[model samples]
Target: MSGTAQATTAATGTGGLARTWSSFHRAITTNLAILPTIASIVIFVAMIVFGEIAYGRIVQVSTLSNLLINNAHLIVLAVGLTFVILTGGIDLSVGSIVAISSLIGVKLAQAGWPPALAILAMVLIGSVFGLISGILIQRFDVQPFIATLATMFLGRGLASLLSTQPERLPEESGVLWFATKWKVIDGPKVNDLIVTPGLLLAIVVVLIALFVLHRTRTGRTVYAIGGSEGSARLMGLPVDRTKLYVYIVSGTLAGVAAVIYTARLGTAQNITGIGWELDAIAATVIGGTLLTGGFGYVLGSVIGALVLGLMTVLITRDGSIPPEMTTIITGGILLVFVLLQRAVTRARH
Candidate 1:
């Protein structure tokens, strides 16, 4: 009943209320931070359900298996882009890297070179180009966009100089083994669960990327850089090395994608992978990887790639939706996700 006692009780009550509100606010913001990623997942599930109901065979084992087999290269590319994007950098050269790598890979095979040697050369070439880009950005103070753009042109030009026409792998080429398919389940009436070695390779790449981005110290360092390169440097997180590593990973994976793609088609052309860079970037963004960097998942990127593939599949099955409309639809979806990202970011702030 005393005045001082009453005042003290009221002050304590106010402090408790403030603390509760602060905790509540934190919880909401944290949820909002991951909302975009969650939205992507929901959208993907919704698409599958809608497709299956509207178009027969959408959920068939065969269709699903083929989806993975066909887009395996894109999945790998997305994984690589995830790494680079996580570090708040862009790699414009991945598509061109695919063009050049596949060109060399198929040509080498056609030349009667050992498959192992050709494959090794293909991967190493990517890493080399990645290193060049990293050096230009980190050491020479070039912007990532400009540096990567230059490398992109360089890669495409090199491929064009080598061959303008399509290159085909000989039937006896050992690299064809990558395209070999294995049936994991014998479903009835062409519904068997089929998987190709290329798909397996893509799965391996995803696994390795997940490990590197989540389990290792380097992974933590990558997140730190994306969060803030200045802070990462202040914390002694090897920002320079990690930036280089991400680009190298992206380039190397592009090469791997080329291998998978070339094996699948047994052919490569100078124009191969045209516009694929946009697809990879769109997949990453749709997967909820912040364009500004700092938060994303490799698995999310995989799902994003699948969603894009499924869109194309649906278009083909529906026959009413023009095939060319696929890009317009994809662009619209990407715009929505990007806006979603912006909204989530604003909510966090």
Candidate 2:
């Protein structure tokens, strides 16, 4: 009787220990999953603190305002990217698509097209490009990378055929108003807060993206696809249609970004968006979206774009770091985040 009691006690203790360990492990992985996003927030706040200490006027209303203005287009691009990345797909044609849209919008406006009509055309062009990419990827067996790359080439080629040189929008065109500044807060000593319609558009995009990603069934399917396309198919989700939707969203927003950028600069060139696709990808990765897909936040991408914008402001203020160093810094930051993502993925598995 004593031996049996002792055996039973030993088994109960072992079982309790195993359960405790399992619970602890679950807790750790769950926290780890959220760590990248929290890290991005912390890093952004840290940069602000460092900037304020190291550079005067870093937090001034004017400087802060300019940060958003300068990166408004990038924020839009990153949000679009978040959608595709969340579906475990990529769109390398975004930069090229921007070039095509900007060129078309400007040409139409110059040719006496109504601003609203021209803007609609620009958006439609983006959607067409996105639709092409989606069809190639879904209807056919083309890999996302190859399909987007081919579409990227097609966009650039079409833009080149339109005009190899820069086309300037007329100053009197109604489209230019998107870049017109509106004072928000009249601050002390020329530090007033100002914003543009372009910035407002970007904010609206972010809000919409938030709603779609968190509130809709399509959004859930997007995540499911990213988590595992095979499993998503097995579960009877609308995998094909959802994948198409994400690409279309990405392309359409790329058009919107072109509108924002071209209006601000008053010039559209075939080369206008060269290398911009890489920048958007960097922003997305730095924002805590996994390059492998399935985990990310649109708001996080907003913060990530702001981080890059702030870095640019600091570099300019310092007057020591070359403007080109911005890309190098971006590359470094992207790499760090990618490694962190790998660690998280391992833990999750």
Candidate 3:
């Protein structure tokens, strides 16, 4: 009887220890996935609270919806950027691509082409540009930064050549309907939940991006390439093709962003997305994408974009905070995140 009791006690102790270890492991996993998002959420809440205190009704649903609608294009841009960064690559030409596509689409619309055709042309052009960058980087062993930077200048010049002045989108274009507001019933009759098609589209893209990254073999290859290119090549993982695909994806998304922007602003210019590449990169970094590549999350990028959009709104709402402070704060956050990523990488080594 004594022996049996001892044996039972030992088993129970071992089981308890195992359970505790499992719990700890889960906690660590959860933290790794959520730390970046948590930071964005915390900042978002802080911004909302500050906005409420600084500007009356700034925390209202209408105000929040407006902010999201205004920045939906940036959200898409950031998502595309997140994909490129995940593969240890950068796309410097996306902003210029956006400008070019927007200008081209608007010009085509002005020339009496159907809105659908113009939109398709814009997206295709963007993908073509991305393909060029990918080919250059993969075929020539060019650094991603330098290759994309060259494309950036080319895209910017193309956009400028297309039009010397801002082109207004046709008021009659059906595509503009995407910017139309929809009211989801909330509580009382007039206090409805407001939503924009642009917001819905952004959400959908983020969801699809997450699914692709986490569920597909091609996506896994991207992570693998980012983690170790030499190993990926030895494994016969289609490294060059995969890298090219990522750029194409980024460019295609940028073109879509141009359509969204045209619908929102009803105007396009060569300078429309002049500095947007920086914004997208900043968003990706803030969302926990390692600058050196390999690990990243699309949803994190979405949250990062939201965090930035909210910061802009908050700064605008709070007259006391200088507009320039927004850039400084974004830069600071990026620096901190990069440092943290470096530390984590070094610790692993």
Q: Per-residue lDDT for 1-349 in model 3, tens only?
A: 6999999999999999999999987886655534555676677778778778878676567776777788889889998998899889999998999999999998898888998899899899889999999999899989999999999999999888888899998899866777888987574534456777777987888888888989998889989998899999999999889999999999999998988888888899989898899999998888888777788888778778888888887778678889999999999988877777776666556
Per-residue C-alpha lDDT of model 2 across residues 4-78, encoded as one tens digit per residue: 999999999999999999998788677775667777888888888888998888878898889999999999999
Error of 2 at 22 (Å): 14
Poorly placed runs, candidate 3 (over 4 Å): 1-26, 29-34, 56-58, 186-191
Spell out the clash pairs found in candidate 3.
none
- Number of backbone clashes in candidate 2: 0
* TM-score of decoy 3: 0.89
TM-score of each: 0.92, 0.91, 0.89
**RMSD score of candidate 2 (Å):** 6.2
Model 1: per-residue lDDT, tens digit, 1-349? 9999999999999999999999988876777757777788998899989999998788789999999999999999999999999888999999999999989988888888999999888888888888899889888988889999999999999999989999999998888899999999999989999999999999999999999999999999988898899999999888988898898899999999988998999999999998899899999989889888889999999989998999999899899998889899999999999999888888777
Residue runs of model 1 more than 4 Å from their true location after superposition:
1-28
Q: Which runs of model 2 end up more than 4 angstroms from their true locations? A: 1-28
The ten-residue window of minimal lDDT in model 3 covers 28-37
